[model samples]
Target: MKQQYTHTKLIELISNGGEDQENAIRWIYSKSGWVSIVKKMIRNLGGSNHDAEDIVQDGLINFIMDVQKGKIQKIEGANAYFIRSCKNNWLNNFNRKLKAREIIDREFNKEETSINEEKIFVSKEIWEHLDRLLEQIGRKCKEVLKLWSMGYSHEEIAKLINYENANVSKKTKSLCIEKLKNMGLNPDDWKY
Candidate 1:
């Protein structure tokens, strides 16, 4: 007869970082369905297989640290908790890449190869003005526009913001764009 180890027992081995840690981690990955959960989350977040693999590795490291530090007191439902942590880590990584892309786009879109101090100062003022404008448009409009600008699909945005449907997300985004246009926010103004 084969002996089956429960999740709590596996976590104890992992949390202890003993000689059995590697085996416990392997069992959790295989038996607890951690790999599939992370892969599905990464795919749904528009990430590739490589991203899923990376996120899974990062999540496991984070989970081990949390367990060792006594952050995860209970391990009976650790599989679900670990999946949630992986999803959060993937989302954080996704948002960071999006922000980096936005910054790169803005920097390269400018025609001049050499950036001057005056341009930097002017850019700061322009960004401050844009921030004030976004504040004026109200929180909901700002939230929707920010999500749209991050390249999320209407359905994804709807799910994130709790809208009724993708159509509502689209309509709300369009309305917000119209409001910004009405406020004299010329697209050309931000091109530099």
Candidate 2:
């Protein structure tokens, strides 16, 4: 069994671009390098195989993008970084799914309650405003902001969104946030 993942090989493959990058990806998959890493992460995190695969893909994308942008200079402990990114991506995805379920449950329960019509109308209006603002932002920017709002760290956001690094993610997030601020929505407006 190949114990060491050839980080230099992968980086070189990615840097070369075109068919070389594709071949490198194929090599990784063929060796089950990322898959094994993700499986271990999933097991550690108590996630399923499917979740592990998803996380692995997310990490691979991040690594490839970073290499292509010449953002990652050091390959020392690259495997550790890959594992960390995969775990973070899995956690973020899991949290979002769990939150979606909570929202659905709340909505179902609310339908059974005798809530005042006025309050419902106000809540709907607020959601609509949020939706409109989100629509105004580009899809990528909206996703980045939403992930940030969900309390994902800069590193996690970079992995999830395929930014070159946390610094890049922070800068892009700042730009998106400024756009939102300019549109008149302040942090104080957030209920939670």
Candidate 3:
């Protein structure tokens, strides 16, 4: 257990900027185990330990800088302010990622993502075109699309492609689609 500080005392110590500042930062990090509390909150909010670590680091830096720069003169509590900053950071990061994914989905989904009902990919001519396109991309691009079109789970694609995890496989699949789109893939062009 660590001791808590009054906002005035914390502000003074941090403003002075020396050994006092280091100790003040330490107190803020460990007082009543607030760092663990922050990390737990992040995990509860669907973030990973790595994300928690990043948020905590950024929060500490911003808090210290703000206090030193006279940006935070009064506060109900330093802990609340610090945690709120981190929560906002996480939410912002999550939204940015979500928006990026939406953009990728829109770009990759201009046409129907699925092929013919038989899964032979419309016709043999399309297969040849796809083969050429896949060659331009990479061998794994073809397999990723094939397995994905066959309804194979991302976890399955990860194992098949030696990716570290499902998330990596999913990102790879997105990249493949982006590459194909860059190569001017139009399903309508392959239609007889």
Candidate 4:
């Protein structure tokens, strides 16, 4: 018989990272019924097998990232969370494709038109700058900011990062945010 993983064991393995990270992902893929649910959702939406595979991959990556950053809250169970996340992602992708098709049809039917390419270029530049600023901050600061952005309580952050206490976690996160602001990064602009 195949081994089965409980929700608690899965969460511990995923959150722990390092050697456990790969195993956790493998367990998720191999042990859950959620994968079939995701595939069925996509198929019902007229997605091909390739699309199902892609959506599953993207969903897993997003779910893992959210888990690591502590963005997930109000957990009912691991299977439900994974299925919901994948369904949402697939729906979003389908909507984006519909919008793109509409835009392309409109463009083909119209003649030359004005587009504010400069504004887009400037926005891209600003984002690049922000990315650089984030990288400039030390690794620890980045970790703290990420966890805080993910909506982790100070106590939770402290336990995750091995800090002495919640107070220390709060102080460290505050200082990191301040440093980011001094370097021209608006804390409000960043999201997990």
Candidate 5:
């Protein structure tokens, strides 16, 4: 497709800055087909229109800077060069994301194994602490906590312990947990 502004005209306008630069950019956005081309390329890469817009904006800014810096003076192929810059941005971003995903996957495997081992250790410690704590707490508190730790629901515990309601059972469990904390047992050391 034809560009609204010639390579020389756009570069010269961009280099002049101020109104000329603004017009050059406005022409690129409103008249040139380059933006659509860039957006299509990005969409083909599984990117959203927003991503295309951002990358294209960055590419335009960089192109204008290059012109102002004398790095793109009288360039006959600025259009191709500008489009290439956008493609490079997309490629760099894609590579960075791929690297991040790879790192997370690598760490997750080791982390998952360590997390499993930690869970086992913490579970054992909590049960041992509970056993010793049961001896010190009230009988009702002991039974409530044991059943709670064993995965019994508040409703079930209420029925078993003859509490007025599930709320009562839940409150009793919270109180028992608080007692464990007061006795220097740190009930939440591993979140029982």
Candidate 6:
């Protein structure tokens, strides 16, 4: 039987907070165990090897930070959590780019047509509200919704957003939508 490295062991090493913890992290990745897990996650998310590598590096950094801060108790489920964080971080970057593109599109369109001051004010207000709503959501939830809005397939989003799978993504999305609904913003009212 293959030896299983539990997250608890990693977490314990991390929480110990010393040179030993650093060495443990190095060993985990250097030994190729964590790298393989990260690669699998990256492939599931439809990301390139480079991107996956970056995410894994980021995840490790985050894990270290959390451990140092006494925020993470153990590594019990750290792998899943770390993967989720990496996916959310990546999606957040992607969403920012998407928003920037939309803003550029609007600006170009505005230049092409005459916009009334009242309409511009209303648009600004709507955007402000949307921004507030985005801020209200937890980071993971916001990332998931943003990826869904970007038209990523459920399977891709599951990998990117750290849901169990595509089906979980769908259910989670519905929950997110419900949260939006409770905010009194009907999807039908917004002309996307």
Candidate 1 residue lDDT tens string, 92-133 = 777656655655676679733334333433555777877878
**Quick one: ranking by lDDT, best first?**
5, 3, 4, 1, 2, 6
lDDT of 3 at 138: 79
Best candidate according to lDDT: 5
Candidate 4 lDDT over 28-90, as tens digits, reads 787676788889889998999999999889888988887776655457587888888888888
What shift in Å separates residue 152 of candidate 3 from its native position after superposition?
60
Instruction: Judge candidate 2 against the unseen true structure and give its global Cα lDDT, from 0 to 1.
Output: 0.73
lDDT of 2 by residue, 1-192 (tens): 653436676688778778988887776665646668678769788887777777777788887776665666565756676677778878876765665565567777874423343333355466688789878989889878877865679999999889899998899899988998898775554446
What's model 3's lDDT at 91? Answer: 93
Clashes of each: 0, 0, 0, 0, 0, 2
Q: How far is candidate 4 from the true structure (C-alpha RMSD, Å)?
A: 5.3
- In order, candidate lDDTs are 0.77, 0.73, 0.79, 0.78, 0.80, 0.70
Off by over 4 Å in 5: 1-3, 111-192
Top candidate (TM-score): 4
- Candidate with better TM-score, 2 vs 4: 4
The TM-scores of all predictions, comma-separated, are: 0.53, 0.51, 0.53, 0.61, 0.54, 0.48
**Cα deviation in Å at residue 142, candidate 2?**
20
User: For residues 23-74, what per-residue lDDT tens digits would candidate 3 score against the true structure?
Assistant: 9988877674668888999999999999999999988998887786577886
The stretch of ten residues in a row with the least summed lDDT in candidate 4 is 112-121
Task: Give candidate 1's error at residue 148 in angstroms.
Answer: 44
What would the per-residue lDDT of candidate 6 be over residues 1-192, giving only the tens digit for each residue? 534556667777776657868766886577636668777777786778888888788878886777666566744576666667777877765665566566567777774423443333355467677778767767877777877765678999999766789998888888887887787664543455
Question: Taking the tens digit of each residue's C-alpha lDDT, what string does model 5 give over 144-171?
Answer: 9767865679999999889999999999
- Candidate structures ordered by TM-score, highest first: 4, 5, 3, 1, 2, 6
Clashing pairs in 1: none
